[model samples]
Target chain A: MKLSCTIRKQQYQFSSVREVLGKASEEKSGDQMSQLSASSALERMAAKVVLSEMKLEDIYENPVIPYEKDEVTRIIYDDLNLTVYRDIQNWTVGELREYILSHTTGRPELSRISRGLTSEMISAVAKLMSSIDLVLASQKMRHQAYCNTVIGEPGRLAFRCQPNHPIDDPEGILASIKEGLSYGCGDAVIGINPNNDSVESVTRLLRMTHEFMQRWEIPTQNCVLAHITTQVQALRNGAPISLMFQSLAGSQRANEAFGVNKEILDEAMALMLRCGTASGPNVMYFETGQGSEVSLDSHEGVDMQTLESRTYGYCRHWKPFMVNNVSGFIGPETLYDGRQMIRADLEDLFMGKLHGLPMGIAPTYTNHMHADQNDQEIAGMLTALGGANFYMGVPGGDDVMLSYQDTSYHDDASLRELLGFRPLREFEKWLEKMGIMENGRLTERAGDLSIFD
Target chain B: MKQIDLDHLVQRVVEELSKKSQEAIPFPEEKELGVKNPHNREVLEQAMRRTPARIGIGRAGTRMKTTSYLQFRIDQAAAHDAVMKQIEPAWLAELGLPELYTRAKDMQEYLMNLDSGRFLSEESVRWLEQNGDKHKDVQIIISDGLSTSACEACIPDLLPSLLQGLALKNVSVAKPLFIHRGRVWVQDHVASIVRCKVVISLIGERPGLATAESLSAYMIYQPNESTVESDRTVISNIHRGGTPPIEAGAYLADLLADILRVQASGVAYAQLRVK
Candidate 1:
């Protein structure tokens, strides 16, 4: 019997680092000059970085463990990526290989590793002949390690220095740089709040920062420059402003005020538009004002309608050419009654439930010094209900500490908070609480429909 | 007048009708009904659970299981876009950004009113200027916690983190936007404003009987008008048995890197298909 040999070509091919390097070197030698021209300068830099970061020796030297994928593992993997939802424990080496081959779409460039797979498996997969690119690293530590392996110890650490802070001293900066460089710190950031800062101080600080980064051989792009402002100040200052409130009444009031303050707002917005183009920081947030001392009378003064109107009007008038992220703060009124806070009309108006925000930042908890367990839960639940991109205040407590131990403790607490909401576990708990049993068979009852249904 | 069979049948029918006429039928509205096929009902129930029936400023980042696949995809898309598009995440500082900007602007106007009557958050015509630049993007994730209560309690602390995280990320956040009344859609809308490729919302999914304050990540990629349910992904049920929050943050960064890798979001580039 004669077998057919098929030759296929495809677009968007993944080139190996070695191949790229060989071409680059040959170009330098005046040979293979035609092939070397395809890559742009940035692409070459990226290629060099990728090549230097990962070593073949490390990949092959890593251990591979024999493991079986279990039911729980399967679920986790499927949750991570829907493409591989079936049980793989029963598959033999041949079947596994075949499965991998089929899943790759014959690209020979990509690969997959399910969520629950062992680190050893990941290491093994990283060594495959076809696995020249696209390594799957699940954990943060793993990703960091991968970067380190490829980047080969950034010659110097990147740091953002704020002059006012005690830690921003030259000695402190040097020490921090030493620690990061020796320990493989990928990035360091510094925040400068201009309220209490001086231009002279900032200039000196920026110069020092720039010099330090340059001496350390860190790229300037790694150093980020930013300025922060608030909505009230933006409006008062001159920027077109929008208001975010807990109720519609506050929104309306703000809107009416916008009309009154149009001239001021336009001037402010126009200036902001100019600044935004140059600085690339143009976003606004409206938060319902809250008083630490909660009182119904004081809360009543916080009108939601007027606030919404103000926000709507501002957003409409300015046609804010670009918005980075928009959000509002939860007011004391929401805290008064948890049940009342989830009102449908209020959620729709506030969130634009029909439309989604790219960066929706909500609070998890506040008043850490005074909060109870119920309050914390409410914070976590609100995050889920609201649909946020990042949960910033996952673990907040104990008078706000800047020390390492405190931050670690807070991180642990936050992690614990997240674990409570695991999906399948929650699903199982719901089933058990309702006293309903499943036998793997689909059946229907002739009874009345459920409210949820 | 009829035959024996017809007479018997008529007698039986009359007896049944007389017996039933004395009892009153139960009303359908009053009866409590339970779901029989939970699997079939799960999609509907989950959707309902995620939706807010009435509008009110509830807790931020509460009752969201963002870690779930469905949720995280949605959250991430919005977050990436916020960064790429240059939109600032909301800040939870006292009175939030709007008030702060307004106060600062007012101070500027007060200084400028000697020459003119008005000033704004964008104008720098004051004796005292803001601590930072014009419009920086600060990506933040606030959770209402297990329910709406957590948001009310955690917003304060969340604000500090936003500042810290921004410092850590090395990018100045735009005037931090507060999402007082938040939901999944907030992320998408924010991304559009920010022009970032995606955004992740760290939220609290509804708690079960045993656990409260379970946090989640609702991620979205390229959040905009074209974004559908399929465009969103979730890393949910992030309480105890699920992925931890800090770990989630780290993992989230990795996903962000991945998002950067393919430049495609949601289901499109989340996974690497091996052949």
Candidate 2:
């Protein structure tokens, strides 16, 4: 394989495929923290050149982590459509990028090609594309899933109304849910990140959210973002659960750190199928971030972006209802600043879409990171333009319980209006009935939680 | 006067001026409803009272009202400042904590490099080898993880309560050490040096717009090569607004006692308790 590239009079050499992939990645603090990134800009460009020339078969042959050692690599390899892989075996990464961006290549072609591509190839092509390239390619693919409501329809966006409270206060969570609903958010899921992860607490929140959904007849799903074990326990105790939630990483070690494995996820999916309140199939919701593997010391040697792509590969095995990417949630050690955060969000949206998943972008930022509300808003708008299926709608863009800023209720409404998109068909009708939204715009009666009363 | 004394005097004057300026223009209370006449004003007020979320604040079109917007920005600014600010040396002295340093040369290095904040500096390691209490039942560490404001606000109250609680439990604790620019994993290093059965680090959490004063306690028992993140038990959201510092300290003492009795921590401890 070509491991060296000469750009303008400088020669750059990477020792291995993993090094080339890591070096070719867009600059983020996580890779630099792990000391795996390119040492200089010229070297990065060189790595990209080398990566672009490499064929898909090369990446397929050299998994970042050996398949024998890592279950994540095994899952990704074992799930490959070998017939499709043989068809695209000789295509270079550069050719793959051009083919993906070609006008001839729409969702049908892209979806077919996606079966042959590995996560490394996805990461490779993404590294070679500019921000606009990412946005344009992302806009071409829109994957849909169904649970309580259908997500990722054309000309529609959805939001997970994340109404979290510090102490798992039921009334506080309910109040935020009403506020979110008033603004035409929560069509994706009315999810809460509970402070208490006990089975009893999880069950109580599930019961409360389920009861609220029943009372108002909201056209959305409900979830408690607790540990999967706790949620499983809650389900066993006969709690009402619409969607099961878990945070997944790219590596087996990281998933183990999260107290989850393929068996556990498989069991959860089976249980949700049997006992979950949501409609047929697509009952799992997953949250992924770029830096989790690095922070947990589980990335091995792969770059953050590649690890993120691998996470998508693992996530697709479950056929999740929603795959929310929160690349900036880990703080400065991973993303560094607003620019890096925005780049990560764009890459994740495009990659997740290409992997045939219902993807949402949580263009989020912690106060400690050098990103502000403006940066987050820009990311939200750009990803929305990139055809993200949904975003997290926190009250006022501030998640008091999680202590980060994401797309807010106002941002959720604005994205729909800006894109000339309405809510999910069912949700829009429900909004019209509530007199909060009309003609794809929020009315004067909107943003007032008292309307629910 | 000495140069340090002059610097302190200047800081004091600046602080006083800021206080006076804050008093001059009294900001509207948080309790004031920002929404214009709602369909049901009483219910909106009650809803706003329930969660710290910015609800019931009527939007001007698809954006927040000016007051609500500024309030959010101001809180975000405070949280950013909290992350960047340094804890005062005099405050650490007052708390009687011997200071230790991590390998990070500055805040940028500390934030960007995980390993820089995870290990002690050469001088700090030497100091620990010389002066650290050895073979104690427990070791206490306090760090400005991401928010120094959290340490400044919560430690004064939390430390004393924790000490008292430990005393009541008859648990022998080493003299608590303060490490600058430290992360949670640094506690494992301190534990290795002190040879404690268990180590607890009260570190500042990543600041939120709601409050930059939140702290978290991470307790690990005999951290070794096999220890993963799940090996350490954590209690977070310790602050005036969340779990009050005093209450958190007492609860942490009880938790530490339980861990010691079980001879485990984190997931292992939880599983053992279930059994």
State every prediction's TM-score relative to the real structure. Answer: 0.24, 0.94
Q: CA lDDT of B21 in candidate 2?
A: 82
Q: Largest DockQ belongs to which candidate? A: 2
Worst 10 residues of 2 chain A by lDDT: A194-203
Q: Which stretches of candidate 2 lie over 4 Å from their true place?
A: B1-32
Residue A42 in model 1: lDDT: 44
Task: Kindly provide the TM-score of model 2 when superposed on the true structure, using C-alpha atoms.
Answer: 0.94
Q: Chain A vs. true chain A, TM-score per candidate? A: 0.30, 0.99
Instruction: Residues B1-275, candidate 2: write the lDDT tens digits.
Output: 89999999999999999998878656654844766778899998988888788888778788888888888888899888888888887888898888999999899899888888999999999999999999988999999989888899999999999999999999999999999999888888888888999999999889998888889899999998667887888888888767889998898899899999999998778667656
Looking at model 2, residue A382 earns an lDDT score of 95
TM-score for chain B of each model, two decimals: 0.43, 0.87
Provide DockQ values for all models, in the order shown.
0.02, 0.57
